[model samples]
Target: MAWVQFGHAKCGSREPTSNARACRLEPRKSMSLDRFGHSTPTCEAWTMLQSMRRHSQSFLIYVLFGMLIVVFVFMFGLPSTDSCDPQTQIIVAEAGNFEINDSDVKSGTMRTFGDTLRGGDKEFKAAQRQVLYNMVTTLLVAEKAEDAGFRVSDDELRQYIVDWEKGNPDQLRYISGGKFDKERYKNFLDYYGLPTERYEAYKRRELLARNYLTMLETSLVVSQVEVRDLFEKRMNRTDLEFIKLEPMHVEHLFEAPTAAEVNAFLAEHMDEVKAAFTANKSEYSTPAKVHLKEIIVQKNDKMLRQIGTETDKAKAPDTRFKILKKAVIDNSMAFDEAAEKYNEALVYRANGGDRGTEELENLSKQHRDALGDKKVGEIVAFETDLTYNVVRIEEKLDATETPLDKVQSDIASTLIKAERADKKMDEVANSIFERVKNGEEFAAALEAVLYAETPAEVPPVDAVDPTVVPDDANPADEPKKAEEEAPQRVKVDVAETGPFSLRGASYGSWSRLPMIGDAPELARAALTLTEASPLAPKVYTVEGSRVIAKLKKADTGTDEQFAGQKERLIQTIRQQKSAALLGDWRSVITLSHPEPSLQSYGPWVQALFDQAQESGQFKVNQAFLTPSGSEVAANE
Candidate 1:
């Protein structure tokens, strides 16, 4: 009897008694055989059993092949120690098939932190996450640029790096302590463990991203009507007639808030109080401060004589400052003692020349620059317009928040007093405003309600010369008689008492109006009035006083003036429109291609290691995870 296996070579051996060739068949061929030792035909049941045996044999072979592949992968292929290992090549984010990884994040962090990682691990991790997001976004932008056929040549990229370095020479100087040393800069990169090639690649990416943004910004077009409208709004001017009623004038009429009143007010406006506190907490807290001892020498004759040297010519006025500066630099005297001996300003000299703890923002620019980054006991000399100062930093204090408990009482009292005063002032002002609206003159209404007085006129000095002596008077008695006689008033054509011209006042110019008396709210209120309804609808508080203003006149410029500014106005409008368009484009791109989660790639790599450790598919090298002696020493 002979049998065949489906899709396989038939047995050729002549060993009929052996079972080795019992069901074998030749490759690419199939045959049917009888199962009851009959050569002619087979029964249906026997044929079915033969078919089932062939299929089972094929299924078993497929199962064994799959198992072999999985075993090979687990034993050798999956646990790769090479750079191409799936673990090492895990993708943090993908921008059009460009995979971001932990190495990329590490490079970015190194570039950003340089030699000084300011806030340690927390700052580094935060910066790394941000950098990863930025890198992914930039990569997407670069891809878009490439699709648009934009290409940056090697020479162009090199030139951009050069320009960037040139533009940031001050940053380099600061890092190198006022010297640009290539070796030192290289060492700094080494300290951060950033490779030169990786840094250059980052710079290239930045250049490409910036170019993409510029392309979008430059495509914006602004209309002529927009330009003209912006011009008119910015350049049109007005004249105002205003009456100012100060809170000081009416504050005496209001009583101070009693304890019960304060508590009641706070209870009524608890939400407002909390909101105000949240908004203005920084104002109550003191910022980082430094206490200084200073010596100021004015540019005067006395200062010049003390430190100046006489030659064939007269002594130079600046010589004294130079000498004093040299003396301080030479450490001939302590800063506090020097300030006491040389300081000309009496206010600072009383307490060992102490300037007290002052916020850096409060100091003059020169003083701030001299003291910035200075350590205690360090002396610095800097000059202002009229004075030469030598300052010594006595102490430095970090910023601290003021406890709410301490300030709560004062805040409550102030808020309650202000609220009561505002209500009282508003009632008085509203009554007067109603009268003005009902056809009473604004000046008369003010006078009736508040007894407001018109400004007194001053006689011109030229009209009554104090130096002149009358010819008919006795010389000795004439002086006394002239002094006793009232000076004759000069008739001057002054504008109506309240009428002040802000005709040339454009945007932001109202603050410069001398007639408004340092009240910005008054100036703003005056600007809002129109010729149709000259009177302001509401009274405003300015410098603790209530104010109401009328817009006497508004002069939109003539066509001739508009023609002169048309070109400049168009340029300004173009810039404004371009910025808006750029902003929109940036938003669209960022939204369309969102960044991956901000879980830093470093942590992701660590998580992979953790999973690998659990599965036993890979063994973690403890040495790689442990810091080297040098690294530990450096951290210490």
Candidate 2:
């Protein structure tokens, strides 16, 4: 959604062009580029570049840059102003015998960003780069297709253009009863300032590329065995959930340690408590942090619309920012109250915009500068490239160490709970196991043992009506009271690990139940379990932690499901093959461009474009590319 599409035209309709490509950065992925060099950089311009020495980085700057000047500016600075721009019609690259030019790339970028051009320079550069690459890749791959004896008939080319026009939605105006008007087509190209010959050549190149790509996709046949494997992986996996038995889970069953017992334990185990404190001493030590609340002012269309419709003031960022500053900072409103009243984004409005305590260094430079000299309860305003932050300093916390005396009880309590859990886990497990054997529901049994709610084996006879004394014998023999004992409950937590297959999981993927730790024993039990007897045959001790597992949901592959999957798997495999092929193709084309994320395994193609740049086979000027100008050294 961030990148705009030009391959598809939607008049008033939502349909895309048959060949619409959403720009992206990847090998085998598409992009536009300048065709070749028409003019060299001027001597003075060359002199300036030599002085700067700081060349541009890679096209990966798409990720580096932002709505602000972007990482592009950070890494390379602006491209020699406009002085470094190549002459018009300069050729940028060559694919087979075909030449790519500056105009093609410029036109591509224009079509991509269109009239409004919202994303500024970052999007424009990324789109331009992608379009050029796309053009080269299309031609190179199309040439290969032609060599493979793939011929484009005139009829096929015409049909491709017809499909392209249809994507425009108002295509009916150019076609009468499905017949395209040649004159109308000419007029259409003229409206876009494209010559008939150049435009047709572009369309024909695109048509050849598509046909070749489709062929490659069709050629990679998926085996039935692979399909079945995927089907089992997806459909036969078990949805298993389990809980690790911990002292806290059955805390209710443990009677609170008495003061005397606690005292005795303290005398014997004060060392353990001290050990825990030492182990987690850093947590007891406070770091330098600041507690603050903030109100965010994000620049958006609504704020502009609020200024006025179709007015000059509405288009200006400063005017909208002024209004936002007034609402968020210039007001007499309390910070907390203002957050609820004016923070337009839903995520920002919650908790009255409380950022809580954060390290002061983590604040942006602007906020840090504003808060540097400010004291508690002071407000400061700062702006990021994207949004304005109105902040209230609540407290500046200094790094402080907590005394051991302050946390002794907490340490003791934790150690005592650990002891209690160890004491109760076996008891809880054995009792629950017995109940399950006796046909009591496992869940109910677990719940009863956890919460100390196990029902009495036999209901106590109703106490003889307290007021209604028995008529038999002496009144001295009052009715004996009947009492029922309450069963001990061990509260526990149950966690579910959605679904996973045994083989796939055994191979180190999803091989363990959620919250139960990663144990092969648990994974096997989950897959083999049935709804009738969902519990594992025995309690499992995974590492030091004990757990009981149950199958939450079992999805055994049915013939009908397998039948549906086969067709889908075929389509999936074809897409995979196509992606791989395209990836390999791009890999070869840009092989010389140093990248960290490139394929070194599988098939390797000769780095055609990179080799060409080295061999003087094609022309490229990096200054115009802005970010890839490290290659500008070659021109010098």
Candidate 3:
């Protein structure tokens, strides 16, 4: 990789720049891969590369390279907040003789997501595991396809390209007047970054996988019995009237512990309380250092150079810093809330950026500047070329510890209150199911359990909105258990999942039952319900919430309808079975090569990667590898 200055040497035969004879070469720059990352490139470099490419005139090579760049940018985006490499090396995972690289997992993930790893690192981590599982499975199955004598020839690849060109009528301009123009074809291919020979090889592998799957699947004859069962299940859609409850939603129903109860809890559990305080003694200790919280903003050129330059408020760069400034500086939101809302790095975002306490000697220059002349409760919005920290000086603690005796009463009350809230969540949910199961109406059961207390008999309606399901029901989780504060007017809801097949795809997965979330118990019970036995047998717990569902209605479509849709149903079932068959192969692959397990970058590499940052070598573009990126976690 030589960067040579192309000009005529001591030979005085330079007619013009382009026509110059070969001359003494000069190194334009020394060897460095740094420019490839965040470093800016000179326009001269582009001019030189163009000149070099043209003199050789590798139209096909240039076109393919151009397309690859476009596809890469389209799928993963560039320089996103979470962008960092995964552990140890470029080749991240292995299976038998085959290995899955960072590039392979990344390209495969592009099938289901496009620049979708924006929520934060945890979401990216989960997606990474799932897609890695998908890829490993695909690779092993593809290998099996090859072993089963499945092969895609060069002629086949060429034919695929030609057919694609013919099929895309909008690209007809490349074949004007019924005659293909070679240069025009090149231009057209350039837009798509047309598949090169290497990419063609990848396609060939996938083609083999597809063919092998087809061959195996074609023999899957859906018997009459299976067809009838599938048809019956699909034709009969059941509706469920369900009551949703969460500990977070209804924990308010339980009042604080009585003085007598608090004293009794202390008498019985003083040792436990002492142990809890010892474990979380930081809550009572003050070190001779500064306590800080930061809303971390990634460094970018716009933020570095032109952030405050905008005079009009609307014209500001809408980076994390902009959001943080508005929330913490102007609008007076808590630093943690701002971090949770806007910080790109989950390590800092998780605990709201609290760096519990930092000794002055170990503080970075940036931190020192933010803290200079600032006392406790002060803040400084600060930045460097690499980061912009919305630093809040939470405290400047002296070396001191609050004795356990100082907070013994408060701890005892909290422990009892939390215990009661946990018990009450189940009690309230079971109460609803018990009464409703015993001939009580649904609305009456909810109102009596949630609002006003009465006899065990169910009472009246106290539904929230009743228009749409609560936002929490969108398969998102509730707050963790027992982190209760003041009483909240339980935001409970009563809704009905109209009618759906027990096994039908609702919102893309059967696990995600409509308006009830991934509660398999409620879904299974709903499927079993009929007019005679409408209520689910038990309260189901999901993400700190409980639910009890009743059957609303069931629709059994006519056999004539099944007759009309028989062929389509068979095809869908065949496809599903084929997918499951591939899944079986994946399970086998996973068992064979369990290192870099789907859940993580495996223990062997994790030990090497546990370093705060693998910023040393093999920097994975976090956009590509996603998951852990660099683990320079704030650990607040």
Candidate 4:
């Protein structure tokens, strides 16, 4: 009865019955073979005997199978307790009934951040938090989409892939080798560890999310007033006048920060210092580098003809290369001597063809491959873009990091210098600014503070004598000729107050004005002022010189100009408003589902394992999650 309840069939029953004793006997339709191989018809005693024997054998077999299963359970444990069981997967976190596990977190991290996982513990933890947040948000969005009855049919998914392949020619070429092949595309996904079904499901979720966001954005509207205001801001021009201040001019105004001052500054801005250090640590870490010496020969028609046979024109370069290769291999001359003798580039020849230390990644693929794993003193030859190179690896250095102790002092010194320079410039600017506010002329104040002479003025055209009358001019015709002739030169007014001036530098415009140097900052500042708010002085540093300027003029465009731009401005405003509304909706949706607590996830799993080891509760077999050799090779 127990075996029947557990899904085993009862003896003599055509259908699997739950009750062993309820098995009904059917009419004798087939002859039964006895132990001696004789066919027999049904009789009550004989049928009863046959049923008992069949039941006995079935019972015996079931017991033996049960014993085998019991043995397996003792040896390998139940499915729920097995580490490799899908149902018993390690759950990192849970949202409702959905469990997020270690494998899922790892796969998401790899998909999003790639090899940043190999970075230091701080970087690794940050990447893990980011991946977890993204996964939780994506899951929430997908759940919402499903609740809204959004589903992607098989035909739709197939057509989406087809459209994507058609749109992305480069990707298609890479996957299908320059031809469209459905099977090849499927294989490409498989090779990258993505199955076709999984990819299609991901795309369907992405499409639904996009559609949902689009729907939200459609509700937002841009008013006419907003459009008009935006257009005015964009099209309206500004004319500016401002002073330019240079650090060198005010360097004497302040002293260099003392060591104590630098230390105090560092303490005050420790957050910024730490951020800079973290961001630029790579600059302190040296990459694996190679030093090379190369002999280069430029290929030309003459060289090709000298070494090539007449039969194949394309093979000429190869033939010439072979000759050069044989010459280098024969050791008739050293590489340096050959470079000096044959190379036309002076820098290479003078340096004995030394290329200096170079990071392998910075080199071209052909060069990197040739030198990457080669030994010192080994020679390699390669051809590139109409030139041949025979090179030798002179030295190789393993990548090393500069200790923080060594670079900390240098970083502190640089930061202190920059701060001191800014302080000195600000002090000088404020001093000149006060003088200008007190009604002293801007140019005069700048000259007095910087102890610099005023700029020389360009002479007016009227100051130069009129072009001398032609020696052969008739007296009566001279008056008419003089009237008809162009004036000797056109007289133009130049600004006399400012150190440099740009006339007609309109608001919200970049135009090169005559007579004054191009100083956009001066122009922009000048545009913000009017006659009523005159002399708004500011200092600007231009080309290592301090330019002190004050507003000279301001002008606004007419209403007609604005009217012409209204339609285009409305379109621009609508696009900006739609994007902003969409962004706001996304933010709200993301916040609606708070990120799962990742304290016990990602790299924290290692910490837990470490605690377990100390307590003799667990042992770690593998310590790190570095990519395998094949993975690294594929990436390279």
**Which one wins on lDDT?**
2
Question: What's the lDDT for candidate 1?
Answer: 0.53
Q: Write the per-residue lDDT of candidate 2 for residues 283-363, one digit (tens) a residue.
A: 799777898888665566564223222124524455544554576567666766777765544564667778888987787
The predicted structure with the larger lDDT, 1 or 2, is 2
Which candidate model has the greater TM-score, 2 or 4?
2
Candidate 1 residue lDDT tens string, 559-580: 8888998887777666556544
Q: What is the C-alpha RMSD of each candidate to the true structure, in Å?
A: 21.1, 18.2, 20.6, 19.1
Better of 1 and 2 by TM-score: 2
Candidate 4 deviation (Cα RMSD): 19.1
Error of 4 at 406 (Å): 6.1
Provide the clashing-pair count of each candidate structure: 10, 32, 6, 18
Better of 1 and 3 by TM-score: 1
Q: Is candidate 3 or candidate 4 better by TM-score?
A: 4
Candidate 2 weakest lDDT stretch, 10 residues? 24-33
In model 3, the Cα lDDT at residue 69 comes to 51
| Residue range 1-636, candidate 4, lDDT tens digits | 011011122222334444332222221122221111232222233334444545555778667656755665565333211212223233343221133444445555555555645667655545544554444444445545567776555445444455554222113423455444656664555444442323344445544554555554554576877755554445544443445554544544444556787688677876666666778999889898899888665566654322222123455455645655676677556777666664434467767789998987788877886665789989998867666778889998898988766776567766776666577566667777778878887667666655432112222333433465568865555545544442232211213333223332333334343223555665556545567667655655554444555556444546787688777766666555664333333432222222234332222222332343345332211212222332211100
lDDT of 3 by residue, 323-363 (tens): 67877889998777777776655567779888777876578
How do all models score by TM-score? 0.41, 0.46, 0.40, 0.41
> Which regions of candidate 4 deviate over 4 angstroms?
1-225, 257-320, 334-361, 365-378, 381-389, 393-414, 450-528, 535-550, 583-636
TM-score of 1: 0.41
Q: List runs of model 3 lying over 4 Å from the truth.
A: 1-210, 217-239, 242-371, 374-412, 418-435, 442-517, 556-636
**Whole-structure CA lDDT of model 2:** 0.57
